[model samples]
Target: MWSGPRNLSTAMMYSFAGRGDCAVWDEPFYAAYLKATGIAHPMADQVISAGIADPARVANACLGAIPDGKPLFYQKHMTLHMIAGFDRSFMAGLTNVFLIRHPARVIASYSKKREAPTLADIGFVQQAELFDQVADRLGAAPLVVDSADIRATPRETLGRLCAALGIPFAEGMLRWPAGPKPYDGPWAPHWYNAVHASTGFDEPEGPLPTLPDAYRALSDRALSYYERLAALRL
Candidate 1:
């Protein structure tokens, strides 16, 4: 999933990986690099660094690391992590799909969690720019889900997403047993609460994920970037 932050990318992953035929890998590259090297990311002070330590090295390792399975293989990836010296040739062959939601909600959700680099905190416009680059290269317009859409029409929206990706839809993709996956090491506390709450892809409740007051202006800029892409989809 690609966005400034807090766009429910991992939850989306959990949704897809729930399917019977999917061999889901969560943030595999991060751990591989961490095990291979001990270098710190720029935000190492705030975020725990794990996986393959070097971005380029991590990309190389991913070339053949995707799981082999009868079902689909689900890779829940972060765009910022992918472009850090990633192997474009390998990525070019991927069934690459972008997942996005409003920047305000994303940043707000991060703020609510007290996470760093909230959309406003990390320069959301730049992150959205990066997301655009990824979508263009993939030639597939992003899945472009809104938080509201997930809350309102999860099965229908996800069914459309699966159809677009040429995967057979299944009820299993609606939800899964939550808590920790093998590959989810550091992100559990910060991002897993909502994911764990799912008893099977229930519709979103309450309001959409929110943005921080501090990042509202940046969220506007970020949303502009998203709006441009949305124009194409429309």
Candidate 2:
């Protein structure tokens, strides 16, 4: 369960799901859950209009298939999607990995689409806190990984991730035939970039896109919490 937005979340999904031995469920709760609840999300209008409204059924489907040939399942999740009645207990039986990116980069990518939402509403602070809460209760502090590290030192970082999850790192996890997946199918044009064009992990030294003033301000403010979580201190 990697919780984040536009933070290589989709790419990471392909990386894990692409493996011959793993099964991937991309934000399974999104479409049905959003439709049934009609919950006002950050971009509630856009979200509900397009995806699932009943998330429980998705959960049921994943759990039901677990005993079969499903050795490992990588489920993509949105931090803000943890609305009322969305029971997270499904996490109890699975390994949890929390994916995080600097809020600046996240919002910058998000701002590219319709009705650009705010940091406060994106649920960054609350998500980070809830990640800790869920991880603590589940008896495993999630192996949180930085998106920058995943891009910069992918081999070593992914190797570490696989180790924490008790799996052997495979070369396929590091490289795939570039471009989108079934999930990336719908969002291709709106958020896709040449960066997302390739399937393998590439060096991230290129100039990132320019951001809005609101994003910079909110990112600077929200970063304090992320700093505490990902940084090592005495």
Q: How close is every model to the real structure, measured as TM-score? A: 0.76, 0.82
Q: What does candidate 1's lDDT look like per residue over 1-234, in tens digits?
A: 444345666777777766767766666555543333444433342233444555566456555555753346677665545433445555655665655666666666666566445343433454455546667785655555554566568888777777877887888767677567664546566656876766565556565444456576656667776676455431
For 1-234, candidate 2 gives per-residue lDDT tens digits of 656567788778778866768877667666665565555445555555565566776667757675338688777777766666787776666666677777777777666663557664455775677667766796655678888888888888988888877898988887777666655524455555653677776686355456677677878877876676576211
Q: lDDT: which candidate is best?
A: 2
Models, CA RMSD each: 4.2, 3.6
Off by over 4 Å in 2: 36-52, 120-123, 183-189, 192-196, 205-210, 232-234
Report the number of backbone clashes for model 2.
13
Model 1 stretches astray by more than 4 angstroms: 29-50, 68-71, 82-87, 115-143, 202-213, 232-234
